[model samples]
Target: MTAPEDDAAGALAGTPEEQRAALERWRLVLGEPGQSVLAGGQLSEAGAGRDAALDWLYGRDEDLERRGVRQPRHGGDGPSVVTTVDWLDDITTLFPKETIERLQRDAVERYEIHDVVTDPAVLARIEPNPTLLKAVLRTKHLMNPDVLLLARRIVEAVVRQLVEKLATEVRHAFSGARSRTASRFKVARNFDIRRTLRANLGRYRPEERKVYVETAYFVSRTRRHLDQWQVILLVDQSGSMTGSVIHSAVTAACLWGLPGVKTHLVAFDTAVVDLTADVDDPVELLMKVQLGGGTDIAKAVAYGAGLIEQPRRTILVLISDLYEGGSEHRLVRLVRDIAEQGTKVLCLAALDEDADPAFDRDMGRRLADAGAAVGAMTPGQLAAFVAEQVGR
Candidate 1:
């Protein structure tokens, strides 16, 4: 057989169904690991699903060292990739001061940036690794399978900045409410329930029948309560806003941990699910979030508005593609009503990492009508927004 026929025969050697499985296995194992690898060499039938299959491969990884396999020149089973700050040397030049500072706060703790900063030997080796960036950007492929994953690492970086800043802000918020819990739980040494009950009973005759319920007989409240924060984050979780889910969820985790905040987080594509109750690991929380839902701004906003237990102290944030599947006017009307109640309402059309301003005009208009101030934001900018909203 000719080369093509030989290849075809090899592919079809097994039953037609098994052949298809073999073809998939070949693509998974023999797939192009990087653009540099694919474009530089090897032209074969196996290359047909290279990009799509590799996208799936990276999704299986739980961390960076795994997704883009690397080995340390120092000789260990560990990947070779450089993760130290000395390796990061001037990566800060790529971001704003605030972004850099935020990243440094988180990176410095788990990794030794302080040590790397002083080590000239380590710093000398620091250089831009396109391969690392490529892996970061291309992670979006796991969802939609349509989004170009290029430069996505930028988004992830910004998302981390937002989370770090929000963590600081929330810590401050919790601090500001400091000592209140201790004061609230302090024992009232002057407990005279019987005396108080007798005093109440005396005011009404036996026939008047003033029923005095004793507090000692009352059911105790559970300790499940946390300090109350009335916060609402309106995220446009559409296909266009794909990567922003990580940002919003991380922000949610910080806010969720606040000592006294009743926090509610809702991410929307076409529809929205109230993810307030689940903010444990941002990764796991997001894995539960699937894309491709149609945007229903009105429904989502209304649903969020309903989540506010205290209108006066509540903060409502709306993030979206603005390509809403409902009436903008009605949505804005709802926003206006929520705002009128003293709820702090904010709306953003697109939350991209180094993204442009894109939004649904009618829905934007409705958001404005609702008295919501809308804008385009990145995860870094979102930190300032969160800080301002929480007044931390």
Candidate 2:
């Protein structure tokens, strides 16, 4: 019988043709494993480099010990750090950019390799992609003082990217809303002659030679009071909600600077942290969020409800998966009460790029029954929704 690895590779190494075919498939998934299997007991220069890269990623220590291939020891007490840097450097050549990023993300998430982000040597060898940057953001509390600056730079870069992608669209929507409001006919003092002519053009009679103002347009001088607008973002910071949390943080930061907008952000898990003061800086706000914890939707909603001085002027957005750890009845009640107070309430399963989210659909339906509009939405859709509510 063949070894389990060979069985996994789907070839028993009976002939040269079978061996080569299996070897190629194994190399794609297994990275590097046994020397006898990969090299066929005859290693060449190109094969040796491939073996080294594969070994760093997928080689088993037991197989190395069996082969009697003694691993070299680096100088100092930082062997893991040195080994990590070497692994990163090797994988760059061994994998495509997408695969490399996936591997980096896997390593960080599975192993909790915070050292890779902080160690200058590892940082030097690899590019800081969004996955790694998000990991760094998630683990901000675990970061050392020495790496704080580098971490800040990474967070800033990622935040700026998100802001650049989202700011213009959201701002334009808000501005468009304002323009519509500003153009509303409050007094109807002056007729818009051009618009009047365009409207009545199809109904013109050559014999009569006269166009009637059937629906005359008027220029209004009404100005929207921006100061009356209140936006409260209640974000769930549970581990599964990382993507939503990142988006909510950056969004809050963007909305905070809007003229006449009073934006308040609350990040909650089992514990709630009012991040409104830090909303001006998304990096700082994100760093303050503790990602893994039990969720309390009622507590968060109740807190947000207290912040609403005028419910009619407020837009309350609850960003969560609706997996309540607290009293579900209370959560539903609070959502109903808030909406009844005239506040426009939105219950989002998530506010990320992935519109089809895995969440508690039953709970979302419950909230919907209680008067809140519950659904999964991309950030762009959420932005438009916000503009529509605020402009109302």
lDDT of each: 0.55, 0.76
* Per-model TM against the reference: 0.46, 0.71
Choose the strongest candidate by lDDT. Answer: 2
Best by TM-score: 2
What TM-score would candidate 1 get against the native?
0.46
Write candidate 1's Cα lDDT for 1-392 as tens digits.
34432464454676865655454445445444432322233434534433332333233344544555632224568645444542244444444555444444444333323433233343344332322222232233342322322233333444456567667755553343122121223244323445457556646557767755434221111222343557688776665665556667876777665544556778766667877777755544564666665778888888998888888778787877677578766777888899999887877765545546677676667667667777777655654455444433
lDDT of 2 at 48: 53
Tell me how far candidate 2 lies from the true structure as C-alpha RMSD in angstroms.
9.8
For residues 1-392, could you state the per-residue lDDT of candidate 2 as single tens digits? 88755664564546866766566545544443444455554444554555565555444345556675555434676535427887787778866799788778867776566767867667656676778777876776766776766777777788889888889877766664423222445344445667778988988888999876567665543233355678899999888888888889878877776766789999998878899999988887876778887999899999999999888888899999999999999999999999998998998888887776778999989999999988888877877777766655
Model 1 ranges with Cα > 4 A deviation: 1-227, 352-355, 380-383, 389-392
**Candidate 2 segments whose C-alpha is farther than 4 A from its true place:** 1-26, 30-55, 58-82, 118-120, 178-227
Ten-residue region with minimum lDDT total, candidate 1: 216-225
